[model samples]
Target chain A: MDYGDSPEEGAFRDRLRRWLTEDRSWSSASSTDDEYWTRQASWHTALFEAGFFALAWPKKWGGQELHHTFEVIVDEELARAGAPPKPSLGYLIQGISRFGSEELCDRFIPGLISGRDRWRQGFSEPDAGSDLASLQTTAVLDGDEYVIEGHKIWTSYSDVAEWCLLLARTDPDVPKHRGLSVFAIPMNQSGIEQRPLRMINGVSNEFGQVTFDGARVTAENLIGEPGQGWALAMTIVAFERQPAELGYVARYAKTVSELEGDVRSDPDSTRREIAEHIAWAHVQSEMLRLHVCRRLSERLDDPDGGVHGSIDKLLMTWTEQSVGQAARHAAGSATSQAGGDSRLGTYLYSRSQSVMGGTSQIQKNIIATRVLGLPSN
Target chain B: MDTRLSSEQQALVDVARRLTERLGPDGVVSLDDDDRVARLDQATTEAGWRRLRDDDGDGRPLASGVEAGIVASALGQALGDTALFGPLLAADLLRRVGIDAPGAFTVALVPELSSLAVADAGRLPAAVAVDALGATSALALLPDDGGFALAAVPIAGTERSFDLTRWVSSIPAGTELEEIAGSRTLTGDDILEVEAFALSLASADLVGIMRGALELTVDYAKSRQQFETPIGAFQAVQHLLAEAKTLLEGSISVSQHASWAVDALDAGEAREAAAVAKAYCARAAIEVCEVAVQVHGGYGNTWECMAHVYLRRALLSVSLFGDDGVQLAFLAARRMGV
Candidate 1:
């Protein structure tokens, strides 16, 4: 019933805030791609070394063995301090911890946690974007190894990552969902080619296309039993959608405040439109915060509560585009004027919000069929 | 923070549900008639429904915004009429300012009525509307320099409403209408809190209406058949009902948070949350009821069906304090720091 942090949580937040404020390693920007990734990996390693990497994971798995709320607090504090984002190794850690064998967890969990092995997602393909179960990626068993061959599109951080959690068809005769399996494969293997995919916002190489041509994965790399990739993928997707607790609410609040400040000072003709956008942004941000808290509480009561991550995704995307649009509108002629404000870039970037996690249309369908108990066609 | 209701709140909701069920779905059909209105008022008073918002010696209301919202929702689910909102609203306002309101009272913040019996004070200079149904007295709210100057005014005359269940009237201007002496006023933060409370309560009623309409339509769809199979089996009908359900759930989430904010958060936060709820629910109620009618087919358009009644109530409730656009503009003004 209470939204304020508990006394212990408050002290934990203060300690994290103090540490973040004292950290001097985040100052200078890297001049090159190689330098950028190197710094990112080092920063991630520093986070792990500082015992700030895993808040909700078990103690045996190199996590702090704290409550999930701590993770949310970490997220809030990090965002409030404008710290660098945590590396995308949660899926690797979760998949291995939850479903991977003991041998696999012992061999890979530490490496991933310590930032010695960075990971990327390899699920979506050209033909398997939303209909992910229909992926044509194949992984055939060859004695002790499974040889993987297929193309993975929209694979983020592939260039920077050393490995991937790959989904491939192991048994195509059964249903599309039942025929798949998950594998952790090294990205540096021979015949594994990665090409940069330019995004709509004109950000190049952030997303990539990786073609796995006879990329060999050992039998030990399989996350779960054969024909369990769909379920495993679903698990990973759920993890991916959970709010990155660090400062998501804070970030949105900051955006709204800045937007309000701009709109207050701007003498734009479209004042009402800008104001409406800012207002909606404020509402969505608050809703997002409440939803995260509610979901956290729900998870405590029922670990398998009905999935509302789609709704969260919908709201997040809507707020991003909304606030971004408002900022751009308020920036006025500066957008087209020489040395235009970066609001245009933000507006364009937010366009991918709905497209990234899951499309808005797909979220609506989930809301319609799954949440509403409606008959799905 | 927990969003689930506590056990006591759950019990109160169950009690409200039972009371609402006794009123029946046909209760609203008789609302326009004076005799039925009298009976409705008497029944509600006997049940002590109007006193829910009143405090219990500690200066704390017997039912917080959450409890009041839950009861309002129950009334809405039973297809109860708008006649209930005035009294519940008036009681809530009176309780906050330490004024003793009767079992049935209306609060005025808009002016005058139109021919179809709909209240139309859009063009009026004053911010006042009259609903004198089943009330011994009415509270008039006059905007006074960022706050409210309140006055207890006696019911003078009645105006027939398009919404028959709600007895509408017009308050006199200048020297004619007498403002009761020692009337309570809410200034500064208290005014904003009351405004937010009003929005939350009204939207809670809307959420109830939406839940009721969607449930009714779904039930009808399950049994009512066309071309041999039941209509619920059809994708068109199911999707229509499903969308309504989504809207209904969304409205409920926002409105529930609004109620919680009013009770738990600071005044400014409460106002913003309430504005969000009002903006969403004001339109969602109309859309949900409209779709309910669509799903009901020919029966939906008939006066005998509860669908039209829901639609009428939703339409009237939209402009009670402010409509969707108005609420949005209010939110926009706040965000713009104006």
Candidate 2:
């Protein structure tokens, strides 16, 4: 049950912690929305160059091929040191590593991981909430090129990304799960237009729609097998709760730092609840490490279908929501308003975590039908 | 830096689990009945657990190679006691770490199970020793010459404590101070050591108890149905069960964390880690038991119901070994460096 990091892993985590804490970009600097995003990309690029990004991918794909511990060490250290997260950077590295081809990897993986380019998700259409499979965005295959024309809403950092991991229908004849194809949509392409959709979660900085009208692109931008986008998606998001997601590293440290914050002025209920929630979150992290350690020790490379993994996901998503709720509650009514440091934004972002990666409802369905072997609806 | 458990230590946990199963589970259910209370009745003194720990060399711990088993055995035997495992494990660890107690006599007030004196004075026979009401019968303040005697008192109202497989006795203020070879008083260094031990034990017990409650409720939800299909098939009930599983799983995490923390005492972060773990376990255990009962329907509320056993036992644990309030103070204070 000992889930402690190895000496080397510990050393790496300390190094990351020291770097993140010492770096003014993540620590002392308070930048405008534009400055923050651009600077974050630069910082991420630095990390990518350091071989600390996309650690689990094969070396051939510009990854270090290190153990999951390497990733955990980085995430945990960054989180504990109060380093601002590089969401776009994380997404780009992992996306390219998993779904990009040899050509794509050759062109993007090294630079993307080494923090050269920013990435955004072009998954959600305005009408697609939980019904993502019903995305109306269409991509017509042409001679050695694809004509893409559609609108994707809630596509985070659409305007800022150098590339977009867009999911489109190339074969609508197949079922929703099989008809889709994922492409490394170039955000800088001529026909593509990004419009920021400001929300309560976004800081008036764009988490908007990507309109691809007559967007022309070479077939090379396609990621994974065409028509297997959903499966590829499941494969990627399946790693959401895995150690690769920084469940090993960042999430735990985030809780600890939050616990370390100045929350004493809040109500007793708020303070106690925050403390309890942090502890619970810490527990969730420990469980993740235990499950991961046991699996790694036994060399058990089970897929996400295993009961243990589901249990980990269930615990994580639930606690994520709970902690988010606690943060909101602890802040009182003002937390939801436009003012005050974006507790509301974080709360909103966290609410969608369960829904975005996998909703609690969907997760339970998986646990009952697949993990517990109970019949489904 | 090595937070990884060695294979041998991992095996030690397995054996501990096995032994706990053998010792009559120290779970909520064990704390649930007349049988538990009756078993702890002073009538069983000669054959009871106090004899096992306080026994002469005739006991198993003194035997070579059996010491590891003793750690597991103490955990198993004190399943209901909740407070003994810490001190017992600490004593074992002290030997393992080769750190001598430096004295032949000192008393450990299982904090949760026993009370203590604010000031140390001479010995004299005092009136009566409180039994910590029986959560721990390790030792109590008593009076002698100028100090106090150690007398054992039976815990009141706690006969109903879940997992009543063990016994508790108060040692009056001034009971004759027997200088055992390794009797280390609850002193400065020993306090942290024992605190860690106690928290770890309670956390582990919560994990086992929580696992049991979840199983029971899941079974009941499946067997007892309302809308044609088993209620467990319903999303709402499934959600309820999911919460229990989440709580149980969380309990396992923190509980195991505390145990592992104890194993790595020099980490500097160990005590704070243990406190956090224990505090979370207290809340999770309570929630698990309460929800487990809710899931169990009417059967869970019965006087003889096992669910109540776990519930009551979990409640008792909340206040012991540094209650949630105590821990919150310790943790928040420590984090603030106050």
Candidate 3:
């Protein structure tokens, strides 16, 4: 068993580190949420141009066709350099690559990979947050076009995305899961309206409540067979659940470092309790990092997707919450008293870690039922 | 990097598991089965499991740390009552100091049992020998000029440990210790190497204990029925087990990496990695074992139930080198310089 990077992986990591150090243009100096997101987009484009984005995708589609370890390396370096996070478009890419036709893949993948065309996933709705299959969105066949009508809540980056991967019900009479289908709908049309949702962190551009009145997509834009949406959605979320793909370990490392700084700068904060909290925070982060590495290693041996995604999601939630609490403790009054401080923002954002993507409760239920084969009722 | 065990390592695990399951004590009553214990001990000795870290012709060990960890984990899983870790650790220390003395030797720990006992002026301090079983003496570190030397002190007496599966003994204060005549003085790096190996093995044992306890509880939950249905069918019970399983999986990951790091990384880095693993595994094992007991209900608190055995074993491992608190403090000082 080997934990250190292989020779090739070490070379790739060194090269990526060198590139990050040399090119500082992608570093964001923005103050406002709008400017931050704009810089984030620019950063995404910069990473794509540097051949570091979409690393695990097929080489034929503008990806590097490298191991997932390379992507993890990119994340570690980006976090170490304090660069903007790589765009979380792996789920969309997986949805397309696995379920999309050649024509659809040819049309959408390259643009997504190049960061020229931004996209948002329309999975959650007001009523279907965790029970996503119960979504009320409808996509009726109208000649060669599918007229989409739905409201997607918590739609990340919806305001800036040119396209949305929308899931809607195609047959109301069938089962909730079987009646759904995925569509690549254009978000620029007049039929779609995006209202930005201001998060607790006071970030408006990060999430949006998008309302689709009568968005139209060509029948050819359909992701898979009409009834294949449930399977496709599951596949996408499984990829989304991967912590390595999200660069969460690096993100946690950065937070822990910041917390360490906070504790060091304040002599009064050297209390044993505070030190232990920070130490545990560091331990949790390392645990998550090693756990993700083992998962990535297992993927190399057998790439089959399984319910292990739920395990990863649960562990990530634990680590994030732990680090967030430590940061809050270290920051003390500064977190609440100081305005526009990233520490306060980060502490608040960590509250949403267990709620977003999938609620901790739901993830546990998935593990209990699917992974452990426990009875649902 | 590959984290999966090699086929040979996998086979070693299989052999260890089979041996323990066949001869290991099954219940509290079986703990008194002297015949069974002897057979198990003989099997482990014949298999050369304790000599995994013994020196090859060169300075390197006969097997990697991962192989040693695999056997350690198996022992913990079956609650195997033998002296594998003690002998293995003793061998590791002797090999690091370039000594060839081999027998039923374990390492002597400080009075707190938090670290190896450091002898002074050719005399052994009052110390504890863990997993001493049939061992007559334990190795200790001796101060030599600016470096450390290896010495062996006779075990003065035995004490009943909380972990019934292993033996704990003590050394008298000011006991004369025999320093290996030809053994070379060891550097700080050698100490760290031994430390890394100890922590890795302890972490792996915790991982196995957690898994064993969880598996026992999970099986009970499946078979034990209440309110006209199996308890496992309840979401509360299922969620508890699921969370336990999740923690166990994470422990396995970190523990595996720590074991691999023992030989793969530099001494300092390997010790850091092992500390991280121990901290995580120590806390996690306690929680997982508690969950196991909780899920087992009234039976869990009784002596007949195997859950308490796992908890007892985990408690010893947690404090063997240092618990999570100790590790966290060490890490905070090292990483954050706080």
How large is the C-alpha RMSD of every model relative to the true structure? Answer: 4.8, 6.4, 1.8
- Give per-model TM-scores: 0.85, 0.77, 0.97
Model 2, chain A: how large is the TM-score? 0.81
iRMS of candidate 3, Å: 1.6
**lDDT scores of the candidates, listed in order:** 0.69, 0.55, 0.85
Each candidate's DockQ: 0.33, 0.23, 0.69
Predicted candidate 1 versus true structure: per-residue lDDT over A90-119, tens digit per residue: 645655677888888887787777788878
Best by DockQ: 3
For candidate 1, the per-residue lDDT at B239 reads: 57
**What residue runs in model 1 are displaced by over 4 Å at the alpha carbon?**
A16-54, A70-96, A106-116, A239-251, A267-270, A331-341, B26-43, B82-84, B101-103, B112-132, B142-149, B157-167, B175-185, B219-243, B293-305
Which candidate gets the maximum lDDT versus the true structure?
3
Candidates 1 and 2 compared: the better one by lDDT is: 1
| lDDT, residue A182, candidate 1 | 89
- Model 3: DockQ score: 0.69
For model 2, how does the per-residue alpha-carbon lDDT over A1-377 read when each residue is reduced to its tens digit? 34566787777777776666555555422122444554666666667665667776678766777665465556555665656543434434555566767677788776566656666777778887668898888888899988898888877655667877788889888888788988876778688877776654555454677789898767888887788788766665555544445342354446445644645443244455456554444444545544444444432233233444455666666556655664565456675566745444446656655665557677766666565544444
Give the per-residue lDDT of model 3 (tens digit) for B48-116.
999999989698899988998998899999999888878989998888777777777999999877899
